[model samples]
Each structure stands twice: as C-alpha cells, then as structure tokens.
Target: MKKSVFLACLVCFVSVLQAQNFPILGKVVDSTSGQALSKASVFCQNTTFGTITNNEGLFYMNLPNGGYDLVISYTGYEKKLLRISNTQPQKDTLLFVLAPQDNSMAEVAVVASNEVADGWNKYGKFFSDNFIGTTPNAAHCTILNPEALRFFYTKKRNRLRVTAKEDITIINNALGYSIRYQLDSFSYDYNTKISQFTGYPLFEEMDTTEDVKKTWVSNRAKTYLGSRLHFMRSMYDSIITDEGFTVEKMNDDPKSTKGSNIENLYDSSFYFVDSSGVSVGWDGRYRIGYRKVLPDKKFLQEFRLPANASVQVTLLDIADGFVIEQNGYFYEQYDVINSGYWAWKKLAELLPYNYEYE
Candidate 1:
C-alpha cells in the first residue's frame, strides 16, 4: 500500500510538470489613428472560449499551449485575424487596418434565356479586383431605430444568429421632408423573406420643428438619420432601370393603403449597372425608398455606421436569383418603431438561376 501511494503521487507530480500553459496579453488599436479599440471581441475560431478587450484595447487571458486562430472584431472596422503558435507568456502589439466593404461586381457575363453559355470565371476575379474601395465617412449617417450596432459588433465573429422574427427599418429625412423607407422581415433561418417596401410613411406624428430642435440626442443619431434619408431619396430620384433587376414602379399589393394618391411616388427595383457598366449586387446597389406620414409615427433610432460602410461578396458563376415580396401596414407610429414593425418587414430567398416566374 505504501509503494502504491508513492507511485500514485509520483505520477501526479509528473503529470503536473508535463502540462503546458501560457499567458496571452495584447493591445488592439486602429492602424490609422493608433487609438485603442474598445470593447473589441477576441475569440478562437471554432471554439467557445473568448474575451473582450477593455476600454483601453487591452486583453489578457490564460490559454493552453497550442496553435490558435484568433479573430478580432470591432464596430466600424473590418475583422482582423491572426494565427498564433507561441507558448511564452509575452506581450504583443497588434495593429489592425480595416478596409471598407465594396458593393460592386467587377465582371459578369450575361446570357440570354436560350443560350447556355460556358460557365464564366469572372466572379472571383471581379471580387478580387473590386475589393479595393474607400470607406464611408464616419462623419455621416442615417438613423436606425432600435439600434443594435454595438451589440452586433461586440458579439462573436459578427455572425448574427437572429431569433424567429427580426425587423430592420431605415428612414430617410432629406430637405426637411421625411420620405423614403425600407422595412425587412426575417424568418428563423435568416433569409430575407421580403426585400423592400417603399412609399409608406414608416410612422405618423412627424417631428415638429420644435421637436426636431428640442428632442436632440447624440450627433451620431442625427447624422445617421439625415445621411440615410438623403442617400435613399437621391437613389429614388436618379433610378433609370432600362436594364437591371426589374424594379416595380408601383406597389401592386391591393392591401397597401400607403400614399395611394402619390402617383409613381413610391417605387422598388434592383439596380444592375452603374454608368461605368459595372454589375452591382442587390446587397448594396439596390436602393429602397420610403414616404412621409403624419408626425405621430416616426421610427428613427440612433447608432453609428461602420467607418467602412461597404460589404461585397463574390459568388460562383451560378445563376443565383433573389425572391422579393412586399406588404403594407396600418400606421401605428409608436409601437411600430418602438417594438419593430411587423407588416412592413420583408424577406428574400435565393432561387436557382434557371428558375423562372410569371
């Protein structure tokens, strides 16, 4: 028994000695400004253990000795990743230079319905060439209601797993006229069930001149509200869709009672090509417009836009199409904006390229 106990103790001591551990400490900062990246999320790919950088962009964690793929994410910046294979308790400084998301297809081959042309290899090349673009100005923005920008940024990988239903409302207030709106409804699987619904005043009780002046929040909210509104209104006015995703000029839903008298005032469509002959994707090129309602129903919330305001995805040369649907709702400004608009939300699904619809 004495020999057995000694053997067990010896084994335990050896095991402890063989175990490996290290302390990983680092500071994350903006490459350009050298400013600390606060609340940045740091994690290992395919693992649940994670930590967030402090306000000073500093993080310290004890990790097992092994190779790790580390991901760093923050609001208004492109995600950064690094492969670390060190086991020394050491301090390291990492600088992250974030680029904006580009929203253009640099090259695309268009084939008619009858021709089964050779599969093209333009998708990857186009995405690569077009990956370079300037980020949107951090100084400008349009307001979003129920703003969850920070929450989305601080989460894991910026890959959001929304619940059964989700709502996104964008409002445009240009030239002091509250016009242009887009509402999206989502299913549990996270497909956009509806893409765009325009012309409906997202709310009633327009902010009075007094309210606009008195009910002021942060400058971020003000800029977002103003910039988003301006961008949408400009797109609606300049759209010339002779060739692109067939944009509907008017709401066909008989159930829609929004701005019924405003002839051709509300339109929704997919914009295909810019003047430069570049094929744009629905993710960014498509412009959604909304209309103004009474003062009582505004749904504008405040949040920060990504400094790099663009996101571009390149697809395989498959004929992937998106489904678009729209619906109308009665004006209930407070509940709609505060709790999220139900009827006005939209969703979309990717259909096979060969699929056709009447």
Candidate 2:
C-alpha cells in the first residue's frame, strides 16, 4: 500500500493592523529519532510569507491576524500541513515530527508509459495555460522544473492525468514569490474542458527593491478583488451588492418542477440569502455573476474574450453555506465547482489564505 504521512503546526498571531505582530515559532524533527531536520521549507500555502528552518530545525515567521494553511516540506520526507487560526492564543514552540518516505512507494509506477515525454511535448502549453492560468500575472510565472512531470491520457474519458516525481518549483516574477509545489493529483477532462490539481505549495517572497515591492502590493490587491475569496467574504458579510456581485440561486433539484423558463428561475427570490435569512449551510447550486469587467489591456489580449464584458459564473455542488470567520478565513465546507469566467482563474490568481483587504 502507498504510504503518506501528515503533521500539522498551528500558530496564530495578531496582525499589525491590530497593533501587535506576533511570530509563529516551530521546530521540525524526525518522528522516530527526534533528530532536527534543517533547511526545511516552511511557509503559508499560496502566500509569499515563509522562512526556512535554521540549523536547529527551527523557524519563525510573522503572519497577519488570519487563518492560514501552513505547509512544511523537506527532501526525503512527506509534506505536512497545519491550519493556523488567528483566534487561538499563541502557544509554545510547536514540534512537527515527519516520517520518512517509503522507498517502495517510489518504485511503484501508477502509470507506465514512454508517452510521458511525448505527452509533455504535445500538451505542455495547454497544461501550463490551465495550471498557471491566463491572467496577466501568468506571463511572469514559469515552471522551473517541467521534466519531473509525467502525463497519461485516458481515451474513454478524454481526460489527461499528470503527476510529478518531485516538487515543482515555480517563480512568479509578477507577484515576487517562489512557489514550491508538491503535486498530489492533477487531471483535465477534455469533454468538460475543466482542469484541476491538488497539491501543497510553500510560497517564498522573492528578494525585491522598494519600487518592486510597491508593484507587488498593488498587483496583489488587484488580484484579491473579484476573487473567490473576496466573493465568499462578501457573501458572509451579507454585502453582495456593495461588492459588485449579483448572486442568484438556481434550482438544481431534478425533482422540483420549477418550469422550463430559465429567466424566471433566475429571480432574486432564489438568492442564496433572501428574506428567509442567511443560509447557514446550503448544499445546492447558485449563479454568481460579477459586474466588474476586466478592462486591463493585458487581460483583453491574453483571453481574447469580448472587451469590457461582464463576468458571469456558475458554481455547482456547493455542499455548504458560505462560512467565513471574522479574520476573513473561509472554512472549506463548501466544495464549490467554478465554471465560466471564474474557472479560468487558477494558481496565478490565488492569494494566500491569510490575505485580508486593507
């Protein structure tokens, strides 16, 4: 059987906005021997905030007051993820014990093929487009190690599956961050034209000058707005209109005889939260439309979608109500499936879990 290990280290700190900045302290060591593992990469997933473990296998990072999915990675060991909550009180130095990877698991090949090389050669561009996204910032993102990637195509399903032999390093020059991603699963269905990848990423801020820092700050804010995170926050706050979102719920129940009139089905009565009060945990579908249209020249040229067009999107299989904490941390109870405009936004548009509006 394939063996995978998981460990978590949660550290909550108040942000500068709250008048105090706290440091998250932790140590990484071997599970069996309790030996320190130095040079381990530690960071909040998707955010450009992280630091490496020192010689003592210790690390300290200052994170803003919010919830984050912290990731710790090292060579020859299984990656670990910790969900840190800002609401929790700061604790003593957290200890993470990592188990060694079983060598036998590496020897077993899930997909045997020489087609791996040919696949990357044939579908490299398509993979990059869907994975890194077509956003303006995507142009600055480069996959540093593409050779470690392996691919397999399923004819019946018309889907592509990809895996990596090791961690994939991506340099986001536009965002001034280096992302080290350990890909667990990846697939793209040709029939649906939808792609998805599950992985753990550790983001490291790139060394930059003061001027470039300003650019990143501006760019990050731009990317944050109109994002899924922003939408969720707006929904939780009951301020959809203020956030430029026109959310209308759709009846997905096949048994419900709501008639064939699509326009009538889009009535505001079906809104996620109406006079019935906010839906605590809705397990249904909804149409999320954004009025903010992208007018950036780079976006227009890259996507080639009509100029100044409204962004209309649909989300399916949402199993729960949009729940958000005071610190802008969204719980992952809703397994939302994004389609249309939002579907195109990928890692390139992803903000850190701890990201908060200024």
Candidate 3:
C-alpha cells in the first residue's frame, strides 16, 4: 500500500477493549528441510501478542477477540504473515513453513547494480519522516538497526525503495515500548508525493516506572482519539456520531474538498456487517473529519500548514471495499488508502491489537 494507498493488507489500526481469549498454538519449520525452526519469532502484527518457538518449534499465544496478521520470522528465512480472526472457525493449532531467503531473487528485485552506496546517509531522514512519522511521539522513537536496511533509487521513475535484511529494532521511549518491525515493502513516489511502508510490527512493553506508565497511558489516549482504529470501532458499534466524527463525500477530483454528508455510514449499498467482518467503503473518495479535538500543532508545523487548521481530516478511497474486523483490523486492507492525517500517524503512534483501551 502506498501512502494514499494500502491496496494495505499492511494495516495499522489495532486492538480490542472487552474481548474473549483466542488461542493460537503454532509451529514453524524450514520449508525445504521440513526441519523445525526453534526460537523463531511468532507474533500478531501491531499487537502485544508475541512469543518465540520452543526447542520443538512450537509457540503459543492468546489473542483478544479481533483480527490480526500473525507474523512468523526466523533469521536466514523469509517472513510469513497469516491474516487471522477470532470469529472465524477456531483452530487448535497452526503450522507455518518459511523458505530460505532467496538472495538471487533479492538481487534481481532490488537491482544490486542500482543500489545506493550511501543510502542510509542519503535517505535516512526521509525514510524516518515518511515511515516512522514526524509526530511528537516519533521524536522519541529510534531505529536501532539502520545497517540492516538497503536502499535503491530508480531515477527514471523518481522513486525510492527500501528493504531490510532482518527485523529492525525500534525503541519508542515516548510510548514506553520497543517495536520489532519486519519491513516487507517501502516505496516513495516523487511525482505523486506519496509513500507507502508495509511491515509487520511486534510491540514489547518497556520496563518503566509507574510515572512513566502514566505518561504512556496519557500519550496513548491522545494518540487513539480520532484515529483510524477509533473510526473503525465506531463504525462497528454504530457510534460514528457519538464519537464526534463527521463523514463527507468527496468528488472524483482528488483536490476538490466539496461533497455531501453521509447520514448513514452503514448504508446497505456501501457497507455490510456480520460476525466475521464488516464490509466498508464509499463510491469515491471520502473525507473523515475528527471534530472532538483540534489537529496536533506539531502535525500542522510538520506539514507546514496554517496555524488556524483545526479539525483532524483524513482523505481516503477504497478500491472496491474491504472487510474491517472488530479491532479495526481489515483485510484486502491494501484496497484502502488514506492521505491526510491517518497516513501521517505512522509507526511511532501505532498501538497493538490488545492494548488496554480504557
């Protein structure tokens, strides 16, 4: 998914409030040898649910009721993601097979010849701003392993691409968490001025004092309000108005802000709800405006917008439609793309699927 694109089965919205326990008993193995891969990392992307395989390549995790991209990773092997949900038919156990990293394929795809020798130095800040974000919380976040990242520039296309050899460790001091991100794909298009970074992130809570925890809670609360997760949860519970969100339809012109109000978000033509997942979309581009709070001044300053900007607005378009789950986890997620605000809140402001939402 690009910035104005997900088309994102690399979703960012996460978590559940009151939910049931769903168990995932899993095993990871080398696809070629059929040998168990011990110590393999098993995690639900964007959530606190994660663990490592035992000597037998077996791992177990209990998830709060919702959707998740279950990520499995081992060094020297390719990463795997299984889109899962609690509402689907329950399975007592699951198996994952990972192939060895194909360096030949990597070379062909990454175009070794076009590699930027001084990539990190040249594109570090740019990648950080676009992927990790430029928000206040982002300032406290740090990528610990720039060495694992590779960069490529396609001058003809005026695009930048970045990939990683291993899971990148990111320390988020502002939110009191350490993030392990398995970047799948990240590309930025100069002409469109859009960037997309798709990755599976596993979050681990940092050891900190109660004072710091309190600050984290406050920061998390601030981050959650008016967020994509908030919006999806609101739609799932049919509380769009109560949550202080306003939806306006935008015309075909991406630049045009003109549109009409959507009195019902669950209109039968554009949406359908069920126990599995909720189908959500609109005819064209739609503007989601958050009225409960003012736009973060830092965001305005980062984007160099007027100081008078008030509402937090997100412009999005869904190709056909996508299925959104209870915790805001959606699939065929890449079908949806957001431009303005939500895309601006990247990895730093992200929270997990099991976050305690008070």
Candidate 4:
C-alpha cells in the first residue's frame, strides 16, 4: 500500500456487430459445494454483452467474432476472469467455479470511529474524479449507490483502499445506459498519484425515442474517437500518425530521478517508435500524445487543459496476441494512465465496446 500502486480500470466491453455471430454458453458453480450458482453475473469485460445465470446456473451470449475477457461474479464469491476466443469455432461449453471469499483475508476492521463515513466524506470526490473521470460526459454519470462502498485510509502510507459491499449502480445519461458494477478491488496511492480498480460491469441500455437514439448514436461515435479502443486499433493498423497521434518512449526506470521540467520532457525530440514499424502484439509502454482538440462546447467549459496532452499506457504481456475486431473493439491486457487533457474525460465520455459509428 505504501508503494506506487495504480490499478486503473477504465475500459468497458460491448461491441455492435453487423452479421457474424459466435454463440457462447457457460455455467457458474460453487467451487467447494459443486452447487449451481444462480443469478450470478456473466459478462465479457468492457462490453455491454452480459447476462445473469439462470436457476440452473446456465447462461448464453451471442457475440461477434473476436476475443473476449470473460468475467463472472457472484455475491460473497471470488470473481473469475477467463480469456475467450470466438475467432475460431468452439464445440464445448465453458464452465466457471467461483470460490467463496475467505472471511479472514477479506475482513478489514475500521478502528477509527465513523471511519467509513469520514473516509467517504474526505475521499469520495477523489474516487469519483479518478473512477468516473473528469470529462464533460462524466457529468452525466451518477453512481446510484455510494453507500455500497467502504473506504479505508492508511495515513502512514498515504493510500486509500475501496471495496464494494454490494454491486454499485451507475446511470450514465450521456451514453444512455445503466450499469451494475461488481467491484472486486480498488486502491489509490496518493504518493504515486495512481488509482486502480477491478470489477465486472453489466450494462443495460435505456429505452428512448428514435430522436434520442439518433443523438446517442452520434454521441457514442464522438466519444469513441481518440479513445483507448481507437488508439489500439490505430496501433494495430500502423496508422498512428494518420489518426493524429504521436508516440514517444519514456525512461520509466524506477531508479530514474524525477525531473521538474515538464514541457522539456514532452518535446518532440524524444519521440520514439518501434523500428519494426508495426505493432506485433500487446507489449510495451509508450507516451501517447493526441493532437485533435475537442471542439465540444461543454467539454471546453468544464475542463481546463492545453489543447494537446499526452497519456502513458502500458500494454501488458498477454499469452495470446491482442485482438482488435473489425469495428475497433480491442481485447487485451492494457491500462491507460491519463495525463493532461485526457485525465479530465471520465465516465461521461465512456462508450460501450459494442458501440458502432453509423
């Protein structure tokens, strides 16, 4: 907790497809009891495609051809993450066994009086700023159940840890969706200025009129541009420059001295790129700078940052190669470290993985 621990969870999985369909079937059961777990949430992480298990613990989903980070969660049980691939034909049903949380390991006693209340009052804004984001769209996002969150602050380590006692409901007016998120782990290290969270989210679209639907369509497209999904697609296609992005390598050595000259560090002279001139897979850290200036009046009014800002992102090593679907839906191990302008854009600006530009 004292170290620079950043667990940023900003991506949602949902993809809109035209025709290709891959059906996925799975079941959830208790690991120790071997009993079927009904009402357990099953979802493809980062996408709006998900469902709850039936009484028989069975669930099914039809997804477009691609890879997926499949997640399953149930109350009082450990969350399960599975890599799924619909790119190839599958003949077997998938199964997941969730273990009950070990009470001893999961318990955290609050020593201070009204610590939960005080911690929320003190760090709720910080959690919201980092979790929901500070973008114009984030303004439309409202967490429906803040009480489900329990916060613990360790002053000695300057770290704040958050855990969800229940699924947190969030309504996103900007994207026209309501999400139920099962947060497994969350931590913010003030010393390192990094925040991270892991959860499984199930999204339900709001019912709306044709006019509102059209508006959402346009809005989703706007949010998708220059997003993490778009950036990964550009990298896969080797069109970074065409997409108005520049890449630079940074000295991320933990032993390196911290420098004070921010502007000098961002100078174009230090720009870097892979000599192969192609993205082989999801592995590397780079400073990504976007040149496109957001023209949204609302964004301009709410956020204050220079027109150009850079974000640091690391594509964690994956056993299998990263997958980018035909529609720019990305499936891989990665995290975005927002800085400058991008840091201000939060949940309000989020689009589901299945979102498509018409």
What CA root-mean-square deviation does each model show from the true structure? 24.1, 10.0, 9.6, 12.0
Q: Which of candidates 2 and 3 is the stronger one according to TM-score?
A: 3
Per-model TM-score versus the true fold = 0.26, 0.75, 0.89, 0.74
Candidate 4, residues 127-209: lDDT per residue as tens digits? Answer: 88888877667778899888888888777888888888888888888878888887877888999987877776777789999
What is the C-alpha lDDT profile of model 1 across 234-254, one tens digit per residue? 333343221111122223343
Q: Please tell me which predicted candidate would have the highest TM-score against the true structure.
A: 3
Please give the range of 10 consecutive residues that has the lowest summed lDDT in model 4.
6-15
lDDT of 4 at 133: 78
Best by lDDT: 3
lDDT of 3 by residue, 181-263 (tens): 88888999999988988888889999888999999888888888999888888887889989999999888887777988897
- For each candidate, the alpha-carbon lDDT, in order, equals 0.33, 0.71, 0.85, 0.67
- Model 3 misplacement above 4 A: 1-19, 108-111
**Cα deviation of 309 in candidate 4 (Å)?**
8.3
Between candidates 1 and 2, the one scoring higher on lDDT is 2
- Candidate 1 shows a clash count of 35
